[model samples]
Target chain A: MTWVYAVTLLILLISLIVGVWRVIQGPRLADRLLAAQLFGTTGVAVLLLLAELQSLPAARDTALVLALLAMLAAVAFVSRVWKVRPDSEDRP
Target chain B: MNLLIDFTLLIGILAIALTCLISRSLFRSVVFFILLGLMLAIGWIRLGAPDIALAEAAIGAGITGVLLLDTLGHLKKTGNLENDEPAPGRKRLILAIVSSFTLVGLLLWAVFNQPTPAINIHLLVTEAMPESGVSHPITAVLLNFRSYDTLLEVGVLVLAVLVGLALQTDQQAQDSLPGLPNPLLHACLTLLIPAMLITSMYLLWAGADRPGGAFQAGAMLAAAFILLHISGIKLSSQVSHRMMQAGLLLGFGVFLAVATSSLIGGRPLLTYPEGGAGMLILLIELALTLSIGLILLSLFTIANSPPHHKDQGGDHGH
Candidate 1:
């Protein structure tokens, strides 16, 4: 079971690395923003895995908070930053 | 396997932080900064500090990211987002590198050369836990044992909000950015906001027994408020101005009153009376939670509002 958690976490970390690449190689701001969203999801998964792996119940609470707040950055990005410049939708 | 996981996390955190620092685009930098925070939360968990991890999740990943994105929006609105400032001079770069290396070296040296303490603070805390009025050691330490520090910390939060308020000339300065009137966002807020509020209360309640506490819960509450504000439900307008102000100060006022109440009993400041510690700590935490929520929201709204100089100029012209 611990190995299962470790393997899942490794896979998630790999996905996060790939997401970082997209963020870095972004031809568009949307791509980077999407990558950030990916990180939020991946972070929640990682936290949950850690909670199970370590038997730390509090880590579950952290995961819950992370899951709840994950969309906030996207909401802020779309409403406040992205929508401000309709013309620069693809601008990096 | 554990070593591998920790190693990967360490490398990942450092790499992300470096990328965030060096990213040429401000937007990319901000995005990477958020990523760094997410990674750091995991790192905190790996280090076995769930309390810090929770704070990092709420404040570092959530509130700070939104604040940065909001600032970027302001910069974009002012047509300053693409302004390419010159990079630092070579001499300055060298200074920065040297200083950073020196700091790292000092930290490593300190880590390598730790002196044994004469007294085990953990032992003291364990012995004192029964009387501290909380099952959670962190809470006990924060609200009961070292409550003076908590009191001052709340004072600092209040002071920060007051400063932001002072900077605004008009009490009712309108936010320049209109609420996002997306139908889907509004629909989602129906579910999300309540969950956030419930979670906020849960975190507060959990603090007495677990890793959750006032600051993390306050940040959660602030996130909910910001979500509503952005989604077209302006809390500032819904509530009376006087009521809003009182809400912002309620925590600090309650905390101060409680701290001073101890003085009346000839106890030193912030020391709870015998057998009353639990109630007092809870009362203080309850007030602190609300005040913290409002203070954080006020900071956001204050930043969201456009500068008052333009409004003042228009008034002068009229």
Candidate 2:
């Protein structure tokens, strides 16, 4: 059971690495923002794993906070950076 | 295997930090910086501090990310951000490299070579918990054992909001008109906002026994408010500037009232009577939660206001 949690955590960390790679190689701002969203999701998963592995339930709340606030960055992007490209909106 | 995970996290943190610094576009860098904050939050969790983790995720990443993105937008609007800042000359580059290396070396040495503490405050806190107001050592410490520190911390937040208000020239008084009418997004927020409210209240109450507290609850409330703002629900001048000012000072005022009231009973300032400490702490926390939320919401609202408002209108600053 412990190994299962560890392996799951390892996979999440790998996903986080891949996410960072995408952010760095981002050809568009949206791509970077999406990659960041991926990190938030992955980070939450990792926190859940850590909570299980360490037998600490308070960390669960951290996961909850992450799950909730992850979209904040996206909402911010849409609010301020939403360009008036009705035609190019489908590019993503 | 555990050490392997820890080491990998360290590497990830370093990689993300470097990317945030090296990225060409300011906006992309800010995005990466949020990722770095999440990684750092995870790091804090591994170190067995969920309180810090909660704070990092909520305030460090969530609120700060919004502020940074807003700043980037402002800079772009004013034609200040170049896609690429010019490369540093060799002389400056070499100087940067040397200074960074020296700083890194000094930090590494300091972290590994620090002497052991003469006393473990953790043990002392747990030992004193029975006498303090609460079962949770952190709550006890912050509100009972060292109430002054917490009081001053809340004061600092109030001061920050006051400074933000003073600097708020209202040049950008345009309340953000929603970019597009998305009923779907509105529906989602309608569901999410209630949940956020419940969670915030839960956090405010849970501080007595768990890792949640006024700061976390207040920040979550502020997030909900900001989200609502983005969805076109203005915090409007309907909240009247005077009423808003009172809300900004609500926590400090409550704290001062409670702390001074205790002094009349022949106790020192902020010293709760033997059995009433818990109840008083809860009362103070409830008020602090409100003030903190209002202060944060006001800061966000002020930042979004137009720079100049000769003819004040809806959503204009005081």
Best by TM-score: 1
What's the CA error at residue A21 for candidate 2, in Å? 1.8
Give per-residue lDDT, candidate 1, residue B238.
Answer: 86
Candidate 1 deviant stretches above 4 angstroms: A85-92, B305-318
Q: What is the TM-score of chain B alone in each candidate?
A: 0.94, 0.89
TM-score of 2: 0.90
Consecutive 10-residue window with the lowest summed lDDT within model 1 chain A: A83-92
lDDT of each structure? Answer: 0.86, 0.81
**On residues B1-318, what C-alpha lDDT tens digit does candidate 2 reach at each position?**
899899999999898888788777888789878988899999999999888888888888888887787667554544445787788799998999899999999999999999999999888898888877778777888888899998999999899998887777655466443343567877888789998888889888888989888888888888888777665577764577778788878888988899899889888898888888888889888888888888877766777555344434433223
> What fraction of the reference interface contacts is present in each model, in order?
0.72, 0.58
Q: What tens-digit string does per-residue lDDT give for candidate 1 at B224-301?
A: 998887665899778998899999999989999999988998989888888889888888888888888888788778
Residue B221 lDDT (model 1): 93
